[model samples]
Target: MISIPFSGSKRNRYKEVKQIIQDNGYKKVYEAFGGSAVLSVNLFREGLVERAVINDYDRLFDLYPAYLDIKDTLIQKCLEAGFIKSNKRLNATQRAYLQSMIATIDEKYWRLLANNFVFSGKQTGSLKPLYFTYFHNDITTDKQREYLQTVQQMERVSMDYKAFLKQYFKDFDDTTMIILDPPYMNSTQKAYDNRYFFGLSATLQMLQMVKEMQVDFIFFNMIERDVIEVLKVFGFQDFEVSTRRITQTSTSSREDCLAYVRNHF
Candidate 1:
């Protein structure tokens, strides 16, 4: 199995996931809930799958292509515009500059860096300093340019993912396979804020709709009793658990990892 390490895996459970999809005769697959799109990318890269169907409710996905295409151009502009230094400790003027940047610079710079930034990754827009500080020119200009160029394909790949899902899933049938990874409740997301919270119920409803039409799918779900009961009612019998993350990672004093889909998947 092609293992992409972007998200957590419990005891090689993802291996089982890869195997199930491969054995099902599904060359064209769907990622119904693509958090990072890592798995689809892995499958495409490893030649285990021929095409993909990736969808997420988040609108930020629309910006992925633009971000990839312009990533280096934006960084170069920042450097040319006087961005410099490492761990020099943001001084008053520099801090003010960063604050000002949060207001006018590209949103991509901010959204990607909010994790380790000052605002703890929840703030809206590019108002945090963490968004702008990663613009250091640590490598030769040529290398940085090449690296960003490589990422530029994300735009093309995203576009391809969108088109493939639209064209193929319009008539989803027994031949089609769905990989479900519905969002679970967590710190960065909540029931009302992110679609995954109360969204699970709605997503399950969607799954029911698809299943009724004879769509072959397996859910990698949060082992909520209600959700489990709902799946059981729909005749879903197979499951496996993976402990990706249970609660908010930043707030937990110590990791309180919860078992999800471990034995159930």
Candidate 2:
């Protein structure tokens, strides 16, 4: 039930993905591209996984210690600074205060709080001027406190997915499942920041490496021809899941494919 305001988060597809993992009887989950780490934490919480490793290239991992140690303090500071209270959009004065806090506060706290304010839970990974949004639903302090509790048991690491997989994939056993949710290979849109934009070549290289390693994995990505072909070449079983993309102007339905390789190694 922990909600992280991260762009491209898998929270919506968690139940489906969790069922896949559970059916495979995977007791440990390694979230190779752990954006928001929705699967890792929730799987651990629900007792599907005895161990979870959350790894991401983004600096968001740097804020985990802050959340673990001083979440109450962070919430209190936000409350005192008028950052949280209602489901209303920020006013001009409140915006000014938030801008100042982003300018002056330490990167860890500010970046963590920045997630709650950005439009559509999209992060830019910069201290640049932020596009503000309404505070409501899961973006409240009470919800944050509840969410923070779920992450305490997870092991967090900040590293490029290639390096992370190279280092740890060798240690995985039959009970381990590596969840690969890399950035979309067909989209140029920057989800979190420039660092998150994984080009087609890089995506192919990652897929090739995963194939060579012969480890069990569940991969999530948009239904692109090249990606589907590559997964097919690797002998993965494909399942397409329908999803919606919500923009400021409209919402459109799209299909996202989940490809998995079971104990075929």
Candidate 3:
């Protein structure tokens, strides 16, 4: 899996989830909330899924086409704007420059710039770049090439989960699988700043819709009693539990689960 600098990335657990899909004999896959597109990219690289549908309501999808079609210009703009080769905390001048870039650059490239450079890969806080001191030393030509190549090879869609489901996965059979990683109920505001967030009510509705669609799925979220109860209400009795070590601290951890739902017969 690629090292993506996005909030809520599941890079560490990609192998486990991929194994789950393989074990269940699902060859076609859809990702409803492709935040960092990490899982979809990994599946694409590993050839686990024959048809991979990557969809997201966020502007992050814009990066796919931009990276694939206009690679040189995108990298050149980042370099020219000092988004690359520097990791200083955003000063007044640097902040102003970023705002200007946000206005002028296409939404996809701007999304990449903000998330890749900003602290915690989040756009909510003060615009502090990812690395304070070793920023320049960390990025290399090889990493950039790998990222761009992965983006170019992906099949990306820019749309809401419901729309994508209705359009693509509505007729999915047992061989098809969908991965649903909606905003966690407990960390909606913290991880995504309430932007593009699927709140609890919306999440419940989506869950019901998924149940009705009858497509096989694996849902991921931070474990909580309320969420578990709701899953049980939807006939989800079993879950694959795991520990997620939060990046901000080593001692802190969260119980996470992958709730698998097989297709209706």
Candidate 4:
């Protein structure tokens, strides 16, 4: 299995989600908010789905293809920079080298490296002074190869989730399962880049749109009163699941709920 050092990644929930899809006999999956694209990759790897699509609003959407284009170079650069071989905290000089690399390298490589090195896998454009954390050595050569192989099998795109849904709705069928893991209504947005924040109105609008489409879907979110009420209005029932909540300051396990319309099954 390929692990993505990304905040809000569904690594922990992949097994349960895969089981749900398998039990429902879904042959296709559309990851509406593909943070790391890990779920889709895992499903494809495990042969649970015949087709997978990964879409995201951020430029991180482009990183997968970029990685594929320069997998060797990126791996070599990380190894040369002492990022892939060690799991220790970076010293001042080592940190300076990383910052310099981020400042001077191509935007794609820098963004990929920045995410890997940042604290708790929170997305950042550049490391904040005094906020740089220990280097994550999880993306080794073998892992990179695994990621490349799985991602190559997926259809990836960068677009607004609303636009993505509207365009793909006609293509959905009984065998298709839509995975909606939108940004939480109650999160500080620190886990995400500032520009990708999904506010309440947008969340409600998305829910209303999905309701109208009447597609088979699984929606993940933090438990919030207004969001839950809106989901109830749309006929979505709550399924309580434990998920680790990652924040800028700390990480804790919490009960997160996913809403699904019972009639869809």
Best by TM-score: 4
Please report how far candidate 1 places residue 242 from its true position, in Å. 3.8
Question: What lDDT does each candidate get?
Answer: 0.47, 0.67, 0.64, 0.67
Off by over 4 Å in 4: 7-9, 59-61, 65-88, 121-123, 126-133, 190-193, 224-227, 237-255, 263-265
Task: Provide TM-scores for the models.
Answer: 0.60, 0.77, 0.73, 0.78
Model 2 spans with C-alpha error above 4 angstroms:
7-9, 65-89, 107-111, 121-123, 126-139, 190-193, 224-226, 235-254, 263-265
Runs of candidate 3 exceeding 4 Å displacement: 64-111, 115-117, 125-137, 188-197, 249-253, 263-265
Which digits, one per residue and each the tens of the lDDT, describe model 4 over residues 81-190?
Answer: 66644556677877776565555556546455544566654445554534444566454446655676677667888788888888898888888888888878766662
* Alpha-carbon lDDT of model 3: 0.64
Cα lDDT tens digits, model 1, 1-265, are: 3322223342235555567667666676676556555555455556666666465434444554554445445445545767664544445555566556555656554564332223333444425544444333232234323333332333222332234345555766544666655544322333422323545555566556655545566555444454566656766665433334444345643122222221112
> Where in model 1 is the C-alpha error above 4 Å?
1-16, 56-62, 68-91, 106-109, 113-120, 123-175, 185-197, 224-227, 244-247, 250-265
Instruction: Report the lDDT of model 4 for residue 5.
Output: 54
**Candidate 2 lDDT tens digits, 5-120:** 66344777787878877787888889888777887888898888888988866756557656534445544566787776565778888776656555655654655565555554
Model 4 — TM-score against the truth? 0.78
By TM-score, the candidates rank as: 4, 2, 3, 1
The 10-residue segment of model 4 with minimum total lDDT is 239-248
